[model samples]
Target chain A: MVIERASVTANELIAEGIFQMNVSAPKIAGENPSPGQFINISVIDSWFHPLRRPMSIAGREGESLKIIYKIFGAGTRLLSEFPVGSFIDLLGPLGNTFELTEGATPVLVGGGVGLAPILWFDETLRSNGIDHTTIIGARHSGEHFLEHCPKEGFILTTDDGTVGIKGTVLPTIESICLEMENPKLFACGPEPMLKAVKQFAEKETVLCELSVESYMGCATGICQGCAIEHKSSSISEHSYHERFSLVCLDGPIYNAKDIRFP
Target chain B: MSCNLTVEIAGVSFKNPIFVASGTFGYGLETQELTDSSSLGAVITKSITRHPREGNPPPRIVETPSGMINSIGLANMGVERYIDTVIPRIDEIGTAVITNIAGFSIDDYLYVMEKLEACKAPICGYEINISCPNVEAGRMEFAVDPELTGRLTESLREVTKKLLIIKLSPNVTGIASIALAAEQAGADAVSAINTVFGMSIDTQSRSPYVQTNVGGLSGPAVRPVGIACVYKISRKVNIPIIGIGGITSANDAVEYILAGASVVQVGTANYKNADTARSMIDELELYLAENGIENLSELTGGVIPNE
Candidate 1:
């Protein structure tokens, strides 16, 4: 609740234009922002605009929290430009957490900036001693940076034929499906990718949890800025299509079956 | 010691004066775990309409100097769905539930208000939104024209006996004249200064920063402007003024009340800190008690004129 201005103790360019920064927020890290939960990092020093940039918790090192971000626009670009010691205001441990399934084989899928969530997922599964398989995909080889991929079954794919596989990660997933036993797919990526995975994956046998992105005002549930429709059976029973849920409140994570995407 | 902070708006009293703004608070249900809803005066629901809205495209929000720009498109479930799913859960909180209604037309407003009237929750009042920018018609038309403002208020007055508060836009040229029109039209109160229309551009890309090209700006940058508007309108109208805009602290709320706001709404502040309004109200009560003030009304319009 206390929005603090923490300093960036270290900044590393993990990939070209992609930076991973550790911020000094012992209190925040101690509180433990859950996987799939995000933090709002202030874009600039002044209070000209009230909203904060929502970023996923990459991993938490001792006495600090890690945020992996790519320089996309003014906010991210400005964020990347912050010197190591500059103070950055943050509002965090926000939104709902990814519901961890007990004794389930976790398959983590990430694409581009969406990779941030999976990183936390990997750390969480590792800590819990849950076996997880991470499949990461990028546009090409230049963008494929999976060095931080935890010691689990790692699958890499690129859109261009420059990496492990030539086609999409979905194809790689299908191939893996033939070899691996019943695995729960946890995916966060572009909508098309998630949709493709959702369409192909076995819905009943495989529990799929997805992280979605939307235009938001308050990263918190207020504002109704980030809402996703939830299909209801009662509406179908009544011969009406009724659904309701908010991404900021209900989840940035949802069972793949529950989401009715835009 | 317990922090006793309570304030009243209209005839409905609040446990505290820190109520979340209409669009920012969504329904109280969304933030159940983040903050205690019962601790505040009221939770204003997201702006509801006769029909559901998908809202604007990507990049709906952009960060400004000390504030942020948002074009959230006032997305929400239709009134019927809201009453069924959202309202029933509100009573558990004990805090007053204020519903915000928006429409594409006067008829749409009347329909939504009628639906809200049917809800069982303690609908203390209605905040009629006539200034949301993301919508194509309806809201901006009523807000920009004084005559249209009067008509909308008059229609709302006829349909629902519940106290009506008209939220005015700050984007217009003559906000005072519009506020005067609302008073003439029988509005119970007026909440001012929605987001100011603005945009930020990415120099390198030669494109608008937000996907929506332009959005409404809120935060500290707009606080002074909000205070100025509240002061001007409070002087012009007899109705109690509910000040909103860039209020983030107890001093900001105090400044608005001193400028003539009977109550204040915390919007963008909630985004920055979920407990902002409650903390602000606590701070305000402490300031009042320390100064030996008993009632908040004593500080309303307390500003001294320059000699």
Candidate 2:
């Protein structure tokens, strides 16, 4: 999993602060980055911090892969300024791939910027021809990616009723689950939202998977920088694994049951 | 035909000189699915102490202007458990496995080395890490003072017959003196230029970026300083120098080798690029081949006199 130096083929200002950059790397794009798998984009020339920001692959368009991101900090600001044709290093297709259960209807839930991973997952589910529904939520209507959703079976929610339903995506999911029996949930969002969804679902009936976020270094699972603590009863005699699991290696994606969300 | 890039540091001969730094490499076994460990010069395991450490709390790392600040707190599986679990698995890799030992006391250092020496695995060498700042004691403090560095190096030297390479702290005032002291204390080699102490502050929180207040800085921000330390230490000591800091490209590595480093380790670069070490090896070979240099040994301090 070498970090290949990728050149930005196109940088388009998609919306207000958000910019979509397409990088030219067929080998990495062809690596078949599944849903929930992220590419760590090196922000600036030499500045390492904000360490490498993990950007979910927005969509694959030919040889170039798209990353839709907002300018949050110095790292993202630098990333936004990456002139077209400039080289940016990328450590990819890193982290565990999202599990695809056979013949299971996936209810993709994404909130705010967390919607990044769900877009890829939606594409995956569509390709597999698995019946799926998406519940996308944002703080307000302006932040919604309603246009990006697949043509069929999509639900939209916003904090304010300027556009979709006037609540979080959880309410929409709750309503959907009540109507649909035994729907598999695949979610990536803020911890509170994911935890709420996990608690709402019947453990046996609904197999839920969630992608957790953490600060990372050595995105290739070398540095234990991005580790999440898992509650396990069985303690190993060795000193390594009494508590935490690395987010970079063990998973960016884990069985919703395995994680003890904070 | 190009020659194989092999070098000897602290009496341990590596098939190449591009070993991963302690913390950045994790345990060699973790990367088996991603990389070919056998192709590396050596896989230096994360710093192991006498007991298992849980490491620091959240926000262990933050990115700086051109580097990253890390306060990892030297998290490891303790020496005994590492030998029991990690060493056995590493032996299967067949390449040189260097155990990086970090301790809070002289006894802790000795105990770890004694345990590692007893392992059935072909323990290539012991990289004595006296540079970890996150630890409250027995780390950067030992290397800050030349006499303390010498005493600690001597104590560990007495217990382990295996090759001893003291990893020197760059945070110290006189890095060359520390390197010289380690060499005088019977250390087989000295690894110069560990992380420089630095911190980033969060504007919103109005406090330090890392919970541990201060952290070690590594990346391109520290390359010039690393190269300077290697050049200065290489001039002061005859023992081989394993230069490490912000080596990202082959040119960065070449600069260190020409600065008199016999070998170099890629640390922060590995975080940016997983195949940094192998790519560096390839780039170095290409540089040598292009320059008509026959052997890597010829490049050690190969920098021509500026005059």
Candidate 3:
């Protein structure tokens, strides 16, 4: 992927603390950016904020790509202050893309800010004329942000019973999984929810792919900042010593069963 | 008028003074799609040892306010594997390639160098990686001791006809004396400050951020210490010094150059931008051109001390 100095075309709050920014990243957003990969972005002229914070690619419209992020650290805190005409430096389309088979029915699942990456996943499925279902959950009604998505075949859940469902995405996922035949799942969200989704997907015997968010230094492969452990690797299934993989290189997405979530 | 960024250190000429620090840039192949590798002065391969290394466990790096600490434990394939698979790709980079060697003892260092001497690639020289703070043995152990540093440099000087540059650790009390020991042992040049020893704990988790609690800290956090080492060593010895620590922009490179470094390697900044080394090369040249400076050799050791 290329490092592009994409101008900030639009930056506004979508939910309580979540923001959706449209950036002019032609090469980085690419003609067809796969769903799971993300962008490492930072404030235009701030060398003080040295590391580029990783943001999931929410959507791509025409010449610009959309990024959905929460103000978690110093980098994001600085980015929230940029005006509409300002520029945001980005290095991306990094990490591996979500894998979809030719005929596996798509089932999109997202939780909180994790839904950002899956927004692109849902769009890709819709564009491919694939019939799929979307299940999104947030902490409360104010945190919910899928108003622009289609009403039919969509499930929304909130913790305080202010949205589509009162509980987490787990119930909606179970019911949907039971209905859809040979559904292939794509999910990104909180660790606890991902753990539940992984369990649900496993029990239901459907294919599952997940994206994990780890604290990072370099979104590239060089710095071993973002590494996730696995039960087994390609080199060894039972080898105790080498059970690790880099989130920046091997994946931001892996099969539901491929990784053991903490 | 065209600017000449060419620099000759230890009888080896670099297209510029921008060498990518060992390990931070990872053999320089990953960023080929982002920028041309041949643009930088040189690409120093990751530190390699006699046997393969798995490195430290998970959480190898942690982000500080302005920099990062990594206990990457010289995580790399053995020397033979690197020479067979990675070096050829490095050979194609068409720029100066300096192999950074790491070992537990001088014999381990000698063994790796012997194998390196056999390789027919157009390698300009070797940078002895005696300064890494990530490992439990050999790296810092050899670097902190002036005698060990001298003996290693002296033995390495016996083998191979290539230029020898000793990388010094900043963990020692007297950075200058260790550098002098290296100079006396016949090193072509010395690269200062290979990460100051550091550690950070995740309070909430009640554990160390990295599996190995103590790692080598790099980036802008270590910049002053690195410059100080270069400055201190510059006075004690006359050999060229390759200043490394946390160099982000051209001004930082010039800071090291003014402090008496003939060359500078950009380390932790590469994490922020993969093309940092190339960008710094362009920035340094522009700084020279705009300032009406004809050559870069004049800037080396330009800093004047106060009486």
Candidate achieving higher TM-score, 2 or 3: 3
- Give me the runs in candidate 3 sitting further than 4 Å from their true place: A147-151, A231-242, B1-4, B132-140, B289-292
Candidate 2: docking tier: acceptable
Please write out the lDDT profile of model 2 over residues A1-262, one tens digit for every residue: 5467898888877655667888997778778776788888878755455367888777776667878787887788888888998998887877787776776667889876777788778887788777889888877767764653435777778788766777888878887766776677888888888888888764445788888888888776667676666767774653464567778778898888787754
Query: Which candidate has the highest lDDT of all?
Result: 3
Error of 1 at B211 (Å): 4.9
Fnat for each model: 0.49, 0.52, 0.41
DockQ of candidate model 1: 0.33
Candidates by DockQ, descending order? 3, 2, 1
- lDDT ranking, best first: 3, 2, 1
Model 1 / residue A27 / CA error / Å: 8.3
User: How many clashes does each candidate structure show, in the order listed?
Assistant: 14, 3, 0
Model 1 lDDT tens row, B1-307: 3344556655667776677887777777766645777777777888888887766545566666777777777767778788888777777656888898888788889898887776544688898998742244533567888988898899999987777889999888889899999999999888998888889988888888666788888888898899999999977988888889888888889899899987889988787667778777778888888877787888888988679
Of 1 and 3, the candidate ahead on lDDT is 3
> Which residue pairs in model 3 clash with each other?
none
Query: Where does the lowest 10-residue lDDT sum fall in candidate 3 chain B?
Result: B131-140
- TM-score of decoy 3: 0.92
Model 3 root-mean-square deviation: 2.8
